[model samples]
Target: MVTAKVETAGPLILVVGDVMIDRYIFGDTTRISPEAPVPVVRAGAEEIRAGGAANVAANVAALGVACRLLTICGDDGAAVELNGLMARQGVTLDCVTDKGQRTTEKIRLISGVQQIARIDHDCTVTDAARATLAARFEALLDGVGAVIFSDYAKGVLTALPELLAIAAQRGVATFVDPKPVDPARYRGAFLLKPNMAEFQALFGSCPPDRIVDRARSALDEMGLDHMLITRGAKGILLVSRDGEVVDRPTQALEVFDVTGAGDTIIAALVVGLVQGLSMATAIDQANIAASIAVSRRGTYVVTRGDLDERLYRREHFMTKLVPLAMLCDRIARARETGARVVFTNGCFDVLHAGHVRLLAEAKRQGDILIVGLNSDASVRRLKGAPRPVNALADRAEVISGLAAVDHVVVFEDDTPLALIQALRPDVLVKGGDYTPDSIVGADVVRQSGGRVMTVPLLPGRSTTATLGALGR
Candidate 1:
């Protein structure tokens, strides 16, 4: 599974839903009594944190995503606190209102050691709040990479159909962490994430073995591409056309409160997918996130420091996942000392021994060999109507791992002229009988007082040869 790599989460996320404030009342419990079976408590310090949609945004920001919040709040002190919370977390509040509606607030009463009860207060001005949030949503939809509907069923996500329709029209993926009370509201979302209890509440209880099947059928019936049912103690189940279920027996930890576990899962999943994680990998990260959430005292924000601490403690579990950018730079520097800068541009539609020998010879040239790769679009543009030996990412990854290669950078244009100009290699090498002038970066290298040369072409080793031989 692809673990979190710091720089992988720059994707823009537009979050629209119920934004609320969490007010925690803390006190000491010394004696039980006067009241029937209740302990007499001495009041202590109070605390306030972002809750509901605000909480989700906090989680998103914690993961280093550029998050924008769109929701309604009342012209009250709660709004003041919510605004302050967003600024501190580095999340921008775009769609907001200070109308007659009271901002949604979840007030919790806790004794020194445990939570006793919680109360929720908010504006019921559904019409005004809905209109304000929708206007902001429409305005923010133009450039956002993905949309998240934090449907707490608190009236903010009441207009779920419109939200889904808008995102669909824009070709943007939508993720919804919904309330079980109204499954119909979240239909047609790109993906829906619900905890086990919520899933059972909406789809009815099922034998543990058949739970995934039931969810798949329900997701299809609702027209969703997929569904991720978060099993609190059993782990996470991924349901889709390409289905996968990964189990995580609850991590060994003392459970404090599962207050914002759902919010935590949705936040982590959105960030992972934005950073390009596969469904299964994203689920692992989310499960890790939820594990940390449940271990905390209340609805707490998970920080990078906390994750690093986990990584240090659990060294056997995670390898040193260097960031991709860092890997490229490091390889480039190492090659400068003795490697030859043999570069070849191609769809590399396929990898073969010919390709390997070409790369190896390129490496044998001087100090470092850098390959300028054609992006999927660029490959399709140059290779013909329909051709890319492999997807761009897979191709780059495969090339980067080769022992003879130093770095592989993708360029979407028809040629790697710009990349050549940027890297400015000492020597430019290409395989096959093509002259130096035929190479895209030849001009740049020559202008920079560098040399360009063509390596001997290998016979019967071309991608075309392999494809025709295999009748591909």
Candidate 2:
């Protein structure tokens, strides 16, 4: 398996599989019923999302990779909604139809932060439908960078071996999500990914001696090049004949629903590999992709922007500091993601002990703290005669360099009104000398329902005293 970051990365993956609808019934369970063992739920909201193969396509699309879907669905209401979801996702739906088969759907009954139960509706495809779907699959594979067979065994991949042969002869990189692993269903595949249960179930009786070896031999005999065993929470294991079996652990802090996680991993791996990433890099990318999937509430797919944002947020924050105007835009983005805002202002001339304490306290009031530094001219106007002990740009940049300050905006004219008007902070703070009611911008914030707090200036720790001590 490839170890880490590969030079080449990302590819167009064609996903062919079963399309299932994942429905969530969300509500509260208040009363214990005498009628049965289950608690009676007061239903609140019901949401439906794309699941199964459709979810994999969503994941591929979400990661900004090009993908196409080749599958079958019943001509019904679910199909209509599924098509809408696919169209919105920018994934091509070359999905064929079996007139009588019902599109698969998994209805999940959920209570606040918990799943009460899930019910599945699925059916096998008839021979005539399978032939038609196979023809459609072949026609759709012309320009695919990599091919993924997301066989949920929900009838999309009934003639598995023949499909594998077709995928192989075309030299398309393939990843097969094998289910009900009978070995016969997976023969001649390029890569086989079976969860531990499916792995053991298919080869359980063969030999207890070399469980992994036997599994590898079986895959090798079937003409498969690689095998990935997904051990939930233990992470993923990759087996390639040319290299070692590397086990990458599950990085999930908590697991909500296992639904659609595997689909995300294989889709990511296929994209990474076809895009020229090393195997290790591809799997790591897959691991990162899967880690993101399990944390989400439902079977909804994770978008590329989601993964990129998750991976790049810290870097983005460190590199994307902006001027005051642009800073408001950044702060707006932070608030949209639920970060609170704290504001404090000062000349901060000589970086006094009182300044540090005030900034730290301001930071404690909210998730992100913005320091409004008085411009040199503003400080001179406020303090009278050669006032600002430091230049405005230097002072503002120094205040921004602080660990406690999330951002810094400079204001002229002795007051922070303009900057305050821009940020509309959740909390505004000032030295204890003034009443919270009288602090500048206090009325603007209070009238807007934001809080205003007056903090005590640390005794004898003023910037003037520090400068006096420094000169001495």
lDDT of 2 by residue, 364-435 (tens): 999988888777788888887777767775676677667898766667756898888888999999888789
Model 1, 296-391: lDDT tens digits are: 777877654444444433442332223334434544644543444555566677888878887887777666667777888888887775588578
Candidate 1 CA-lDDT value:
0.75
In angstroms, how far off is 181's CA in candidate 1? 2.6
Candidate 1 TM-score, true structure as reference: 0.63
Among all windows of 10 consecutive residues in model 1, the one with the lowest summed lDDT is 1-10
Q: What lDDT does the true structure give each of the candidates? A: 0.75, 0.77
Q: Pick the candidate with the highest TM-score.
A: 2
Model 2 deviation from native, Cα RMSD in Å: 7.5
lDDT over C-alpha atoms for residue 247 of model 2: 74
